[model samples]
Target chain A: MKTLWSGSREGSLLRYRAMAFTVGTGLLLLVFVGIPIQIWGHSKAVVAVVGPIHGYLYLIYLAAAFDLARRERFPISRLFVMISAGLVPFVAFIIEHRIVASLRAEERSDATAS
Target chain B: MNRESDRQVRWVAPRALVAHLLVLCFVPGCLIAGWWQATVAMSGNGLSYLYAFEWPVFAIFSVVLWWNFLHDDPDEVGGRRLRELRRDESISGERAELRSPDFRTEDEDDELRAYNDYLAQLAQRDRAKGWRSR
Candidate 1:
């Protein structure tokens, strides 16, 4: 029952969540559908569309990850991992899941404390 | 400060100067490549058409990043202010003139301090949990 805005005191977390979802979906389509079609069917059409879309989404994902990292004061290595998550298939989903859970747990504890 | 002196000292600090020099070198290259792609696209190369527009966009983004870096204040850059604010978070500005107040009320300050402490404890716990899971 946690909201996007609930625990994100710095306001970057929600934006990161949205970007993660988009990057995750884009990568999934490109990897699962587009690459398969390009390899087996001898057609470049699916890759032609999904590849550029994923690239653009990945750019936005990088920006979002940078924003979140700055707000969280994350180390550069952690930020690099977050930014790279969008490029690999299904990694964004896992990272996003961890991020959301931690944020929610922090928020729940803060609510009880206050 | 005189305009030329200001430019030398601040606008083109050694780091910014290097960055600006790089930008100057690359923007024209990108534009030239974009132009070549445009010509190729005009001659009916489909993939070159997409890149024809893309290279120019890259040049523009580089220019924007350079401009932001040139004007950015060292202390106030990015989220530093936000981090400071969180550290000294208060509900009211009643003690604004005091800069750093020695005696803080127990209510709002306590909440923030407790939250920070909680976060520290959680981080330690999480590190332990990560090790355990591995």
Candidate 2:
């Protein structure tokens, strides 16, 4: 039977990393790029109008990170850190880098074991 | 894995694919269309117009993308088997085991044979009862 654990470890890890990167980058764009421009360049009206959308996107990013973590069996603490990184400016980039490094390490170990 | 066993195995359908596609198309479409309407009303302020419109769209798109991430494989067969096993264990107090090389295939064949036998016995009884009535 095809179980959840049946996929190639490297492939699954890569998928999770990609998802993390996608979400992290999206959040970065909202906080760094979207929010500042709305508050400074535009008006409070602009921020007000766009606020709901940002909230929704952040929620989605968290959900995606959670799903990937579960599928890959990543430690819950690490997953929480990764999810929280989106809340701070430029933290997503750092989290993304960490994810890539850990994933590479995982791949190397899996390769050695096989 | 053995090719024979792999062939017998079926992959459960990913339930999220359709919902993901719908969100992808609908969210972007709504954002773009909304921006177009706003621009038409405002009569083109250039940088402000693009900034005002695109950010919200991107934000909504990102949220939809994230929402798609929350998924768990629906326990299609697992739940059914758990229920059946629970019932069997309660009644028999011995773990039910099928005596077949391939349990699924063998069980299906056994069920069909039993059904056919039952139908044949019913037909025979009907014929015997008819003769008695006559």
Task: State which candidate has the highest lDDT.
Answer: 1
Going through the candidates in order, their DockQ values are: 0.08, 0.02
In terms of DockQ, the best-performing candidate is 1
Q: State the C-alpha lDDT per candidate.
A: 0.66, 0.53
Report the lDDT tens digits of candidate 2 across residue range A1-114: 233234565445554555556656665666667778877878555454444455556555665565556555554356657767777766766776776665554455446446
Candidate 2 iRMSD in angstroms: 23.5
Q: What is the DockQ score of candidate 2, to 2 decimals?
A: 0.02
Query: Model 1, range B1-134, lDDT digits (tens) per residue?
Result: 25433443375468777877979998999999999989999998776777787778768866865664565445444354344333233312323335235333355576777875675565445444421122
User: B1-134 in candidate 2: lDDT tens per residue?
Assistant: 25333343222334345545656776777677657756764886443554456546554644544342333222533453344344433323321233233322444576777875675565445434311122
Candidate 2, position A11, lDDT: 49
Query: Which residue pairs collide, candidate 2?
Result: A57-B63, A60-B66, A60-B67
Per-model TM-score on C-alpha atoms: 0.50, 0.37
